[model samples]
Target: MRCRIPETTLREALAAGATYAAIARAHGDDPAAVRARCVALDLSRSRTQGRIPPEPVLRVALAMDGVSVARLARAWGCHPDALSRAARRLGLPTDPVGRAALRGGR
Candidate 1:
C-alpha cells in the first residue's frame, strides 16, 4: 500500500524550501508523485531558490582566510564543484592548507 501525502503538509514542506525528493522521502511517496502534486498545486519553488547567491559566495571566498572551497560550499549549502569553479573564476585560492601556508601559518 502507498502512503498519501496531506495537501497542507506538502504545501508547508515546499514553502520551507524542501525539494520534491526530500518531501517524498519524508512522506514515504515517490519523488515523481511529489513533483506532480507540487506542479498541480502551483507550489514548487526552484531548487536554487533559497541557496546563497553566487556573487556573495565569491565575495566570502575572497574575503575569508584559509577557507576551502569544499568547506564554503558546505556552509553555503551549495555543491563543492560549484564553489571550486566560482573560486577559480574569481582568482581565489581553493585549497585551505595551501592558503594558510601562503599566509605564513600551518
Candidate 2:
C-alpha cells in the first residue's frame, strides 16, 4: 500500500527544521520524493543552511585508512551524506566500503 502524507504534517515538519529525509522517514515516503514535493511547494530548506565540516578536519578524516564515511560522520557529529559531499567537494577519496554503506549494502 502507498503511504499518504498529510500536507499539514509536511508543513509543520518543515517549519520545525526537519530535513526532507526526516520527513520522509516519519511519513513512510521516499526522501527524493519528499524533496521534490518540498521544492514544488516551495518548502525546501535554504541551500546554504546545512552542516559543512571544516576542510582540514575532513582532509584528515579522508586520509585515514579503511575508515567508513558513516563512522567518520558519526565521529564528526554530522550525516554521512553531508560528510561524503564535503569529501567530494574537497576532492577526497570516499572509501569503497563507505560508498557501499551509503547504498545500504553493508
Candidate 3:
C-alpha cells in the first residue's frame, strides 16, 4: 500500500533538510513510499547525513562574496565536504566560479 503524506508536511520536512528515510520514520511511512510520492510530485531535496543545511542557507552562503566554503562550513557546524555534496546535488556552485564557466560561455 502507498503511504500518504500531506504536501505541506512533506515540503516542510524537506525544507528543513530531512531525508526521505528520516521523514518516513518520523511520520510512520515507509521510506520507499515517501520517495515514490516525492518523485510523483517532482519534489527533491539535497541532503547529507543528519539534517542538511537548508537550501536558502546554502544559497545565501554561496551568494556572499569573499566567503569561502570552508569558512561557511565552519560557521554552520558542518564539514566542508558535506556542504559541497549538498551544493552539487542542487546544481549550485560549491566553489567560486565565473558566470561564464557556469553558463559554458567561455
Instruction: Quote model 2's TM-score.
Output: 0.46
Model 1 per-residue lDDT at 27 = 74
Over all chains combined, what TM-score does candidate 1 have?
0.47
Quantify all predictions' global Cα lDDT against the true fold: 0.68, 0.72, 0.76
lDDT of 2 by residue, 1-106 (tens): 3335766778899899898889888878999888877777777776435456788777666666667778877776667888778888876668766544544523
User: Which of 1 and 3 is the better model by lDDT?
Assistant: 3
- Cα-based lDDT at residue 46, candidate 2: 65
Give TM-scores for every candidate, taking all chains together and pairing residue i with residue i. 0.47, 0.46, 0.44
Q: Find the number of clashing residue pairs for candidate 1.
A: 0
Worst 10 residues of 2 by lDDT: 97-106
Better structure of 2 and 3 per lDDT? 3
Q: Pick the candidate with the highest lDDT.
A: 3
**Candidate 1 worst ten-residue window by lDDT:** 45-54
The reply for model 1, stretches above 4 Å from the true place, is 1-9, 35-67, 95-106
Q: In model 3, what are the clashing residue pairs, if there are any? A: none
Global lDDT of model 2: 0.72
Looking at model 3, report the run of 10 residues with the lowest lDDT sum.
97-106
